[model samples]
Target: MTPLGTAVTAGTERAWIEFRRGFTNATDLGFYVVMSVVVFAILWFNRDTVVQVPGYELPSATYALPSFVGGLIAFLSVLGVAYALAMEREDGTLLRAKSLPHGMTGYVVGQVLRTTLETIAGLTLALVPAMLFIDGILVDGVGGLVWLPAILVLGLLATLPIGVVIGAVVRSVRQVNTWGSLPLFALIWASGIFVPTIALPQWARVVGQLFPVYWLGLGTRAVLLPDEAAALEIGGSWRPGWTVAVLVAWAVAGVLVAVPILKRMAARESGSAIAERRERALQRTY
Candidate 1:
């Protein structure tokens, strides 16, 4: 097989291997469940809150569902990939991959596949409970359900490579907490996930509009909520065209920046570096 073909095949196999390992492990499952549980609980508790928007009359929690889901997409794509990359490098996965021809390509392809599947799984865990208990979440019924996958895939594309860049750059998983998780959480807050952007300060509205997270939430809300809900959004509209453009732009930019950085990070992986990282991890356990 050609180098590209070989890399593709290797990556596919690698993704499957990672998925199986992750699903079977208790810790991995917990990591997947905890965030979803928190979000569901928050939405569930707020299910009875009065929603008094003009012509926008559904359960308030249902309206908020899109933001939480979008934020989860951002969280899993960016922070999840960063942590995975950081942990794998420390565990010598990269070093082992380095031994193969075009290994970096295969490794990256594997990560992309692995993380996308994981994101879908994580999203399902969160949304399933919301759908079951939170009435009116699927306000548009069958039509809205059709839009869910497209919105999810778009949101994932918009944010996944950003995670790749972060994971590739951070020195360690500990650093990911400071650099990756903190900043993502900050964006989640500022991007109008938990609160409406219109309700935020002018500075915050602009800042929220500048990122894919906001657009993702907006796109999600556009799908799940009724047309009337747009009246509650900034500028009193969903602006589907703008949401798609902005998300596509972010996805393009993230991929452009992430590719070379991922290659550089992979190039730096070596047996000695992996051994040193392992030693540090071992020390941390003591």
Candidate 2:
């Protein structure tokens, strides 16, 4: 097999291994499950209040639930990438991977695949409860179902590169655990997950518009809400087409930034540098 083919095979294997690892990690599973339940329960309980908007019809409880769930999944996937990279760096696994042929490419592919799987799994888990509680989750019918997943995938793709950058920069697992949650919290809040963007200051709305979270929520709202609902102003009127374009731009930008940063990280991880760093860390702790 060609070198690229070998790398692809290795990446696939690594993805499977990581998926199993995630399953075995009871703490992570419990965290995700509990969060999903809480978010959905809150939405279910507040369905009447949410639907009480003056003119537009509110989204079904099922629809709102999935959007929040999907957003959480995306956030957690990014966190997973950061945690994986940080732990590998601390454990010398990253250093070992760098010694293999096409290692950097394989590692990047593995991270992407693993994150994608986790995101999909999380979304699925979130959807089940929504479907059970609310009728007609898709406001746009079959079209919404088809387009929603595509848009969400794009949104996740847009965020993955940023996750890669974070993984590359963080020095250790402890930092990853501590710092990772902050960004996730900020993005969810700013993206209008819990509150509409219109309620925020003008500048905050503008800043929120620049991130993938906003576009994700926008696309999701488009799928779940009626056309008249889309006309509802949030951060200066929601535009589904514009949201898709912006998300694509973000994904492109993420790819542009991630490639070089990942290369730099791979170069730095080579030889004995990571090992030496880990050794120093151990010594310092002892």
Candidate 3:
């Protein structure tokens, strides 16, 4: 086989192995189960409360549901990947990757596949049941079925590389929560995940719009809600074209930045550096 083909085959195997290991790990499994329950509980509590959305006969959960799903997509793509990368780096996983032929290539491919599948799994666990049981959540029917998956894939591309860059730059696993996860929660809150952009102050809405979280939520809403529901959105339209444009731009820019940054990070992964990190971790533990 060609060297490229060999690498692709190795990467695919690595991705599958990693995915299986992750799902089977006790901690990871527990976290998934707990998060699934939390998500369903939130949806259940909100199921009965109806909000007045213009041109929509259903409750507010119709809008909230898509936004919630979109927010989870953004969170998983960014903070989830970043946390995993940081932990791997501290534990010498990156160093091991650097030692093998074309290991970085395979590792990156595995990571991308892992995170993408994880995001889809999250949606399946949390959002699919809501759509099936809840009334008025997905009113756009066949069109939504097509566009929702498209936007989700685009959202993953746009946000996943940002996480890669963050992981390459973060100093330690502990720092991921501080610099990556915390700020993501802040973005989710401001991005109109739980509220309409129209209800936010003008400046606040502008600030939210600067990030991908808002756009992801907006795109999801566009796919799931009725046309008249666009009246509730800022600019009174879904702006699907602009959503795709911005997400694509982010994906391109993030790839350009992440490649160089990841290269540098990989280059710096020496045995001594890994030992020092291990020593520091031991010291903190004792």
Candidate 4:
């Protein structure tokens, strides 16, 4: 390996160690376990009500579960990574990492990888209950099953750069939490997660189309629902091809914007400056 590659690898290893420590410390595993049970319970209790909608026939709960879980995973994963970045900035840890070889790229890669793994695990846990309780939810044909993982990976890739950008720009944990919640809610609402985009007002539909969430939901619905169901109209006319293209475009655009921002953030994160700020804060408190 080239020296840069070696340094990147070593930095990735260190980042992984830190990630594991934080993951365990946060007891995220336990959170996922409890959440899975709760989500299944909700689905079970509401299945009859959910099926009552006219002209809305679903295959199995298992097939429907992944998109819901995936949406949630995407939101939380991005928020978590952003929060981590803000904390690292405050703690001077990011500055320390910068002093190491290939530290910036390796640290960024490790965070993205760790966050992606967490999202996958959470989504998988969500699917188990969906399979057990929601009948006819699994992929209908062998073809769908074979392609499911590939689609999911693409979906994950689509969300990663947005997460990185959120992480890079937010100045504080409080700001991240407050501002982040707005987009999360907006995306979920606009994406037709609870209500079909067709049902939304014209202005809302116009606004929703500008975001990746709409495309993500549209692509997911195309994959999970029957062709006839997918044929249902949205934002005037329904087109799966347009949905896929839009989502891919969003993902590409997000990456293009995030990389330079991350580099800029890294350049600005000086250990001495962070330490001085902390000292001043401490003095003011005393």
Candidate 5:
């Protein structure tokens, strides 16, 4: 078999092993399940609140749930991958992988696949519950059954590799908070995920629109919200085409950026590098 093919096969096996391992560990599974709970609780708290948009109104919980889902997916994908890579890098995991032929590729592929599965499982916990209990969700009904999964797959494609790239670029796990999580948090806040874009400042709106998160939230809202909820958006429309265009662009660019950087990152890994990383991490802790 070709080297790449062998790596992929190995990676798939690794992902399955990790995913199943997660299922057996209650603490880990419980921790992952908390996101869904927190999100659902947020929605439940505002379940009855109504918001007045230009020509329409919606229950805030109903309105926010979809955006929250999209934001959470991006948040989890980026931070999760970033932190894992950073921690593994510090602890000699990447160094070990570097000793194997094509192991970096397998490692990257495994991380991506495993995280995607985890994200899907985590979100399903929130979505299925919210669908059952929250009013005005699944607004498109049967059609939503189609659109929701399609949007999720696209959003994952768009965001996961961004995570990979971020993971590759950061020097250490500690830096991930500063370089990856904080920036992502700021980006989501600027985007319309937590609040309506119409209410954000003009520059914030412009900045939010520049990234994939905004489009992801927009796309999810398009499905989970009523058609008129589009009025609450920046242009007073859903712009489904724009959502697809932006996400696809990000997916392509993220892969291009992540691959070479990840290769460079793996190339630099060594026992000495990991020891230096740990020493620095220890100094920071002390």
Candidate 6:
């Protein structure tokens, strides 16, 4: 195989290994279980309440559930990348990669796969239960046939690169918690995850619409919610064109920006730098 092909193949293999390791790790498995329980509680608590969206009537849980799922994708994509990069940097994983020819390519590809698979694993925990118990999720219809998969794929493409950029820029794992988690939570709240964007003040709603999280939530709702639910959305339509356009725009922009940043970050990685970080981390632990 050519050098590029060899790197990609190695990356793919590394991703599989990481995926298996992630599922087997006790801490990681427990985290997934806890998240599943949390998501189930959210679904169960809201199941019986019928939310009166301006022109529609549906179980409030049904309305909130899918949007929450969509928002989770963005959250996982960004926070996962950020935390993984930061932790690996501290542990000298990136420095090791810097030692091999074309290793950075493999490292990045493995990360993309790892984050995607891990997020899917987490999603399944909530999604399987939601489908079995919830009433309004579109399991078998035109929606199930088409829009559901399309929106999911688009959502991943749009959000994953942005996550990588955040991961590349963060200086430490703690900063990921502070800088990454705080803004993401704020976005989730502002993006109408728990309520309709239409209900937010005009400016707040507009601010929410500016980001991919709101569009992801909106697209998921479009796939699952009935036509009348569109009444609660801006523009009173699914606006598939806009959804695709916005996500694609972010995807393109993220890739364009992440490449240079990642190269710069990788260039700075060295044995001495890794040792310094390790020493600092060890000192903190002591």
- CA RMSD, predictions in order: 2.1, 2.5, 1.7, 3.1, 1.8, 1.5
Candidate 4, which ten residues in sequence have the lowest lDDT sum?
Answer: 51-60
Candidate 6's TM-score reads 0.95
What would the per-residue lDDT of candidate 6 be over residues 81-111, giving only the tens digit for each residue? Answer: 8888888887889888767778899889988
Our tally of clashes for model 6 stands at: 0
TM-score of every prediction relative to native: 0.92, 0.88, 0.94, 0.85, 0.93, 0.95
Greater-lDDT candidate between 1 and 3: 1
Question: How much is the lDDT of residue 87 in candidate 1?
Answer: 89
Candidate number of the best TM-score: 6
Give the CA lDDT, 0 to 100, for residue 54 in model 2: 56
In model 2, what lDDT does residue 94 have? 73
Model 1 C-alpha lDDT versus the unseen true structure = 0.84
- C-alpha positional error of residue 97 in candidate 6 after TM-score superposition, expressed in Å: 1.5
* Candidate lDDT values, in order: 0.84, 0.74, 0.83, 0.68, 0.85, 0.84
| Per-residue error (Å), model 3, residue 20 | 1.7
The parts of candidate 2 lying over 4 Å away from their true place are 56-63, 177-179, 235-237, 270-272, 279-286
Q: Answer with 4 or 6, whichever has the higher TM-score.
A: 6
- Per-residue alpha-carbon lDDT of model 1 for 7-43, expressed as tens digits? 8899999898988899889999998788778878888
lDDT of 4 by residue, 159-201 (tens): 7777778777876666786667678777777666655566677
Angstrom error of the Cα, residue 209, model 4: value is 2.4
Q: Model 4, residue 192: displacement in angstroms? A: 1.0
After superposition, the stretches of candidate 4 with alpha carbons farther than 4 Å from their true spots are 11-23, 51-56, 59-66, 231-238, 276-286
* Model 4 RMSD, rounded to 1 decimal: 3.1
Residue runs of model 5 more than 4 Å from their true location after superposition: 139-144, 284-286
Residue-pair clashes per prediction, in order, are 0, 0, 1, 4, 0, 0
